[model samples]
Target: MQKRQSKHKGKSALAEKLCPVCQRAFSWRKKWQRDWQNVIYCSKRCAKNKITKEPKPCE
Candidate 1:
């Protein structure tokens, strides 16, 4: 016997993740932050190299 398949296969929109720094929406990914839970930055660079490091007082 032959098998049948549906027209729509493996077609789905990616989940949007918010960035902690910029606070913007971004595309979802796998392997790297696949969990998509408790995400910090939108990009690797942003996450790796954070703007604020030391505790500095505001002028």
Candidate 2:
């Protein structure tokens, strides 16, 4: 049997995005295939700890 080729096999860098909450880069995941565009946080913990209020600008 032959192995199937993955569309994202060599596009790792292109499949990554920064998490707004942690300000860290995260790669694409199979579980997020259906909703990759809607992904925001890197993990559940970050999602839970997401900022609720906007920070006030310093004068």
On lDDT, the candidate that comes out on top is 2
> Candidate 1 on 1-59: residue-level lDDT in tens?
88787664342566676776777888766655656776668888778766686889899
- Residue 26 lDDT in candidate 1: 82
Q: After superposition, how far is residue 56 of candidate 2 from its true place, in Å?
A: 11
lDDT of 2 by residue, 4-33 (tens): 977654655558989889999998887999
TM-scores of all predicted structures: 0.45, 0.66
lDDT of residue 9 for candidate 2: 47
In terms of lDDT, the poorest run of 10 residues in model 2 is: 5-14
Structure candidate 2, residue pairs in collision: none
